[model samples]
Target: MQYRRFGKTNLNFSVFSLGTMRCLSSPKNVRQTLIQAVELGINHIETASSYGKSEEYLGEIINSELPVSRSQIHITTKIPPTADADKMRWWIDESLKRLKLDYIDCLGIHGLNTWEHFDFIKQKNGCMQAVEEAMADGRVKHIGFSSHGSLEVIIATINTGLFEFVNLHYYYFFQRNYPAIKLASLKGMGIFIISPADKGGRLYTPPPALKSLCQPFSPLELNYRFLLSDPRISTLSVGPAIPKELEEPLNFADRTEKLTIEEITIFNSLENHRDSVLGTEKCSQCYDCLPCPENINIPEVLRLRNLAIAYDMAEYGKYRYRMFENAGHWFPGMKANRCTECGDCLPRCPEKLDIPKLLEDSHNRLKGKEGRRLWG
Candidate 1:
């Protein structure tokens, strides 16, 4: 396995860190997967309080079943954001107790995905105070945050200089957070990409068109190479449901050398094909079509349309589009179904996109049963 210096924290993280959310299918499965991950040289294990007894199970496995000592592995666990300092401290203590550890290697403020969530943490005598208290008391070695928020919210959080690292969404399919990545790098913060295969357009179950586009490389491998090509990225979370699922990344994690010209060409081909399919109607995500009366995320909705049409990613598109009303601030936007045709965004679009009609098209193509988030 290859390792990178996680900025400011000065810890060396494997390029592929093990994510423990999906491995909770069974106790036997969890034990096998964790053992396999350690044998394969993955030293970082990430879990969250919301991941359904993941911390407890990890404590049991690491304390008894796993062969590695506590000093050989780095454990990262998280607590949800709360305004009360006492509650935040309680959450931290509970995480430590559940993990059967005296100190957490890293403690992330989980799901900092909204302005309100940010405010709750940054408010005087709030969660930040509790986090600092933990650090001062030798309970947490480093502090970071994970976000599924807009660029503005992410950049704002990074600007505070309170975190030593950040976990966020940035992948080949969704390059919208590149600016946030750049800013975090400037701040010397560790950058961890979240759920690259699953949230990254569901590349694990790639469509025929996408598979063809990434010839000679699996879509999963190409996406990994694309993210790792940038030196700024510290690690990518690989969440496997079973031990066998951990094997493929072992082959790809060490190939993080700069992409060859042919590989770069393949990346360009992907964009060109998507643009060619949309022609004049592609969303640049310029946010000019914002300030909608119904609070619809027009660019994101249209971007989903682009993927559904260009890449035959209907299942992935539907899964995300259905999260609009259900995900609260994490996916803060009304669905395209709420478009009142007020003509507010029509004149603002540079592509001259028939905003309402395209929104209706997106709704039709991508709407389905309400989707549930994997973690809260």
Candidate 2:
């Protein structure tokens, strides 16, 4: 596998790193997958304390790979953001014990999904102190954060200069984190993109249109290539559900694959098609038309609609659309059907889109019977 310099941390990270989220089952299976990944040159492994005994499984797996020193593996683990430094340090110690390791290469503040979580980490003697204590004790190396926060909130966290790296959600379709990613790059922070497959338009189960648009390579491979193409991105984390799921990217790396002319043509065609579909109504996602009394997040709804219509990613569109129903604060607010003919947003809309009408049609098209069942 090809290696890249991981920004200011200076770790030689493989462009493809392994995330132990999905295949953290039956120590034997996980061991084989982890070993296979390492043998295939994936030197970096990412896991979390909250990912269902994943650290424990890795503890067993890493030990089994004899002669492989802890230095060679480059392990990273994340804990939830806590206000109490003592509590946070307890988790750090617990993660080391669970992983059966003496030192962790990176410790991340996980799930910084709100401003409160962000501030919690910054408070004097708060979570950062725990990490600093660990560093002083030689138990952890670099510090970072993983977030599902808004673009604005994420930028705020990145600007704080507290982290050496950041774990975030960025893919071909979801460009909301573009600003944060750019800022992190400018700050020389390691940028690790999480959930590039499962949360990334479900490329694992690609629609026919996307599959055709990314020919010669599987949809997942195409997606990987797209992310890897961006030099600013340090690595793409692949959480394969099974061992074989590692093959495509591995083959690409082993063969040192580059985008062929035909593949470039396919990429252009898809871009053109997306532009055509969004003509005169491209959602810049600027949130200019917001604060609907119905409490709807108009931009995200329209973004999901664009995904459904632009890329034929109907299932992805439906899944995200239904999330608003029960997601509470985790998601923004009500669905598009709640737009009660208020002309207040029309004047604010930069695209001057028929907001209510587009929303109703999108609700009709994407919210199918399956979505209703999931929400119920």
Candidate 3:
């Protein structure tokens, strides 16, 4: 596996990082897959305290390995952000014991995914204080954060200049974090992209339209190459459930090359095709027509609409749409039915997207009674 300079940390991070979230089940197979990753030169592993049985798996593997073998790789684990300092402190101790390691290469505040989460991190005797105490004790080498929040919220966390690295979502289909990635690059913070194949448009089960766009390569591989093409990104998380799943990283061992001319052309072709299929009247996702009065996330809602219309992925679309149902700050408001047609975003939309009409169309297509049921 190829490596990249991990920002100011000066660590050489593998282009493919081993994400142990799926290791919760089938411990032996996953353990063997992890061992293969190390042999293939994947030197960094990321886990979280909440990921069941993951820490125990690592502890067993590391304990049986030679000291030199263990030293060759960096391990990262995270705790969710909370206002209670003592609980956060205890979490660190418990993590260390579970991993059976004296020190960890990186410790992240996982899922600082909203303004409310950020507030907890900054509160008196809160998450940050507990994290710093761990560092002071020499158990953690660097501080970082992982998020599933809004671009504004993630960027705000990066600007704090506290974390040495960051882990978040970014892929060909979801470029919402582009601005945040640019900021993290400027700060020389390591950027780890989370769940590229799984959450990244569900490429594991690619739609025919997307598969056609990727061409000769699998949608999964094409997406990996796409993310690696950006210099701002340090590494991508690859969660391998089976032994064969680990081989994809090895197949792309030569990650040094940039995006090929043919790849760029393919990308362009895909965009043009999407534009044609989505019709001339659609949200451009420019963010210019934002700051909705009802706190609706216009861009996110519209993107889902575009995917449903463009890909004919009715069930996938409706399932994703429902994720916003009661998600609170994480996903925000309901469908475009809540538009209220106040004419606030009318003039602001560059596409002149007949915003109210499109929202109605989306609601009519994706909502209840007639909507396609989720795949069995």
Q: Which has the greatest lDDT? A: 1
2 or 3, greater by TM-score: 2
Report the poorest 10 consecutive residues by lDDT, candidate 1.
367-376
Query: What lDDT, from 0 to 1, does candidate 3 have?
Result: 0.81
Q: How high is each candidate's TM-score?
A: 0.97, 0.91, 0.89
Ranked by TM-score, the better of candidates 1 and 3 is: 1
Sum up the clashes in candidate 1. Answer: 0
Error of 3 at 249 (Å): 4.2
lDDT (CA) per prediction: 0.90, 0.83, 0.81
lDDT of 1 by residue, 145-252 (tens): 999888889999999999999999999888899999999999999999999989988888988988988898888889999998889999999999989988887788
Ranking by TM-score: 1, 2, 3
Considering only N, C-alpha and C atoms within 3 Å, which residue pairs clash in candidate 3? Answer: none
- Per-residue alpha-carbon lDDT of model 2 for 1-376, expressed as tens digits? 8887788889989988999999976887788788888888898999999899899989987866734766788999999999999999899999999999999998888878888898897899898898998999899988998987678778999899988999998987788899898999999999999988878888888999878767767777767777787777888888877788898667656433566677677778877888898897767687888778788878888888887888788888888788776754446578888889877789998778888888897888777654443223
Distance (Å) between predicted and true CA of 80, model 3?
Answer: 1.3
lDDT of 1 at 78: 85
> Of 1 and 2, which scores higher on lDDT?
1
